[model samples]
Target: KREGDKWILNGQKKWIGNATFADILIIWARNEADNEVKGFIVKKDNPGFAVEKMKDKMALRIVQNGIITLTNCEVEEADRLQNANSFKDTAKVLQMTRAGVAWQAVGCARGAYENALDYTRTRKQFGKPIASFQLIQNHLVEMLSNLTAMQTLCFRLSQLQDQGLLKDEHASLAKVFCSLRTRDVVSKAREVMGGNGILLEYNVARFVADAEAIYSYEGTKEINTLIVGRAITGFSAFV
Candidate 1:
């Protein structure tokens, strides 16, 4: 039931990207009337809404993330999303975003690989370019191997999406696999950079930390693994 023709929203959302500048935010909240999850298009200038920019981010400095709070925020019934009746609808949104995150992992690894390769070519050690070192070449090869595998896997993943054959388990499998391998590639890229690896100016450090966030967000490794496990075993392991 609408309270005097205005719906009141009260909740907190963390790590909301572009919340400060977004003109319309698709907010997912629990409906007070039916206890089901609902979606709302809340404008940035809504009176009862407040946003705080999240600070102290070591990675993904380019992404504008915020902490949003809704306190009796009023919205018209017409603004509510009609299709979102439960968490299943929310899962639909996350499934799409999770696939995008997998692609992002690929791009991020590619960027780090390119940067580290350039650095190794230019940075000299022991009267020779660091790229000529056998250990450095080995690291580069390993990174390339992981990157190539992740790329091929995500390519098939998108093909599945285009064919409408993607399932939760498929997305979870891709997310888990790509995120895990991206972490490995970024780590190796950093390792090959010597002391400059951790510096943000070197750029690999950002990928390294951002990979951690990508790994955990949307779904953690444990959660994604369980989703795939449940699909294969036909038993829900998530308690």
Candidate 2:
């Protein structure tokens, strides 16, 4: 039921980052009249609003993700976003978030590559630094190549977005490619560290685990691939 100019919200949202600490929440609900999704800005400490912190994440433990529940949560009509009318409008928000995730993948990969390279330089084996060895050098070169390529791809992706020429497929392609490459770069980083790689204090292990999460978020590799596939083939392969 509506009260004056306010509407009621009742539902749950999962895997929301910072939900446990955010002062304001953007709640998406379907309008009963037209069945279109609408966005609402609900303030913290509102009646009937509750949030539970998500726990035991193997990766990205630093991020405070949570599950939010709203029970007859009151939100002013003025709090509703004026432009978001449906899920299609929601897509605009997701598109930007997806691009950010892609760039994050690049950053993660670059960090792993740099750390591993530095460790190999100082880490000695057989009385000499491992970075001097051919095998070790090869791994470093390959890691740099993939990291550089991902950086360039994300740079172009951002440029396209700035130019207003970016499309869903374009962002999807970068997300898919960069995320997969990040996984590879992290793996190489871990491999170069040998047994020390698995140790959390070494940092490579954290990157490895975090890369797994990055690989799956924004959109999984398979999902993003299909998005690009559908665009290129002119056929909707998504079932």
Candidate 3:
């Protein structure tokens, strides 16, 4: 809605990160006239803007998520991102951020795998270190393999991004593959840690929860898979 020379925003945004303390917020809203999405930077002290912190998150607790509400929040046209015109612009941002999510998956998987590996070396079962057992060794090797593959894939994805050769499908493929593999790796980590796996003191349990969050963040596994599938077959599988 327009008020004199400024636009008034009314809506709510969920899962906003660092919202309470953010000096500036990049708010995206749909334009009523054309139904095109537009981006605006709202100052922290805007009276019409309010934020409520989201609580009881299982992972990424250090980052504060919030629910932002705007009731007739006035914004100057100058605060708008001039280049951002439509949902495609918003998608450009998501595509870039999705690559970071893929990297996050790899890091989570690697950390869990490493921590579990160390625990196995010191953890004894039946009077022998669990790492010496054939079954436990298999889990370790599998986790390491998945972790290694994700690392190499992310490295190449970064290179493609740096070279301006990265496409939406490329990032989507990486996001789906890495996040799915990370889930497997974290599960194996918890499995190898046995009874201690669920304990927060053991460290693997935190990764287990965080891995689950990563798996569904940016885009769910099914969503990203459809994106890659569409690119490969020229068929839009998203319904």
Instruction: Highest TM-score: give the candidate number.
Output: 3
Candidate number with greatest lDDT: 3
Clashing pairs in 2: none
lDDT of 3 at 181: 96
- Per-residue lDDT tens digits for candidate 2, residues 1-239, read 35679988888999899999999989889977678999989898888899999999999999999999999999888998999999889878878888999999998998899899999999999999999999989999999999999989999999999999988888889989999999999999999999999998889898999899899877788988998999999999888
TM-score of 3: 0.97
Alpha-carbon TM-score of each model against the true structure: 0.94, 0.94, 0.97
lDDT by residue (tens digit), candidate 1, 1-239:
35876778988999999887888999999877888898888998887899999998877778889999998888888888989889899888888888888898999899889999999999998898999999999999999999999999899989999999888888888899989999999999999998899998998998999988888888898988998999999999888
Error of 1 at 197 (Å): 1.2
Instruction: Give the range where candidate 1 is weakest over 10 consecutive residues by summed lDDT.
Output: 1-10
Ranking by lDDT: 3, 2, 1
The residue pairs found clashing in candidate 3 are none
Q: Model 2, residue 235: displacement in angstroms?
A: 1.8
Q: Write the per-residue lDDT of candidate 3 for residues 61-111, one digit (tens) a residue.
A: 888999999999999988888899898899888889899999999999999
Runs off by more than 4 Å, candidate 3: none
Q: In model 1, what lDDT does residue 31 have?
A: 79
Candidate 2, residue 203: the lDDT equals: 92
Cα RMSD (angstroms) for every candidate in the order listed: 1.5, 1.6, 1.1
